[model samples]
Target: MKAVSLVPSLTEAVAVTLPGVLAGATDWCTHPADLDVTRIGGTKNPKLDRILALAPDLVIANEEENRAADLDALRAAGCEVLVTEVRSVPQAFAELARVLAACGAPGRPRWLAQAEAAWAALPEPPARRTAVVPVWRRPWMVLGRDTFAGDVLARLGIDHVHAGHLERYPRVPLDELRAAAPDLVVLPDEPYRFTAEDGPEAFPALPCALVSGRHLTWYGPSLAEAPRVLGEALRAARR
Candidate 1:
């Protein structure tokens, strides 16, 4: 079954689970490092013409990562689109299974089962800490209510300061974020490429945990090691 994945996590999942099924993918689908598919474009702005030319039997996407108009256009052109919504860890697992099944996998991939076992094996965190997670800077947008990242953090015993915010990703002023006085500031290295030299400076008073965006945000094979990888980064920042 030929498939085109617009989401990076989905692309990796498909590539790893059912090799050579991907006919096209967005430029940002960088996992597997050796993926050789038609580079459609970015997740937000995929090249519809290029994707259409591939004539994939299935196109994988996410409700949050993909634009509605683009999905609509693909459907208008008779392409079957499998859009997934993963707001929590449980939802991510379920969606991954569904997407793989739709791609004609005989059964759940070993990686998916391993990822589930990894999360299930994690012990409850001893204590909870309040944190502010920034996905982007410049305008300073943060993870707010009902985000997959927020859910992931919660499982790691980190409570988002903006969990009660009305918007999912609110653009709060830097001053306001500082004023919130969170116990820690978590920065992932994507969507904005936050680094030790870059993001930590903004939260000089608070410990900033610079983390891998793939482990912190992406919901595929990375989920298997996210608990361990993110826990180490958070612990290091506290120390």
Candidate 2:
């Protein structure tokens, strides 16, 4: 099976879920190596002919990433397409399981049970909130309530100050950020790179830290490392 990924998260998801589910049964490939992603947004200027030529039995797309028109064409060509919309960590896991099941992988409940056990072992919440996590900029966005990032922060005992008010990945105003007054502002390296110098210029009054976007945001197998890293950040903020 050939998988065409326009987005990085989808790419990562396919990488983690497909092999385990397929049980290495199908040889798979992806296009646009080093697909210059500026933010969480997916592929631009995809090489369609290459993907079409692969003649995949299954084409997985994200409801947020893939173009509806493009998916339609693939379906019309007789490929079975499964589009997943992963808004939170649970949804991501469920979608992964769904894809795995569709690939004819057996014993999904066992895998999910193991994953749940790992998730259950993470840190508890703190008495106080610490930081705000912004995954994207330009329009100035944040990982808001109930998102993968929010869940990570919650696990780390760090409060997402805007969790109650904002939607997932919302474009928050600079003034609102100032008003929220988090102890530290976290700038992520992936999706968008935000530096300390950039922080002073963007919000002169706030302290900032450059964090690993992948660790804090990725919801798949990569999540194993997130709690430890985020726990460290939580400890640092307290110091």
Give the number of the best model, judged by TM-score: 1
Q: Which stretches of candidate 1 lie over 4 Å from their true place?
A: none
In terms of lDDT, model 1 sits at 0.93
- 26-55 in candidate 1: lDDT tens per residue? 999999999999999999999999999999
How do the predictions measure up, each by TM-score? 0.98, 0.74
* Residue 30, candidate 1: alpha-carbon lDDT: 94
Off-target runs (Cα >4 Å) in candidate 2 are 16-45, 108-115, 164-167, 200-204
lDDT per residue as tens, model 2, 178-200: 78878877777766867666554
Question: In model 2, what are the clashing residue pairs, if there are any?
Answer: 6-43
Number of clashing residue pairs, candidate 1: 0
Residue pairs in candidate 1 whose N, alpha carbon or C atoms collide under 3 angstroms:
none
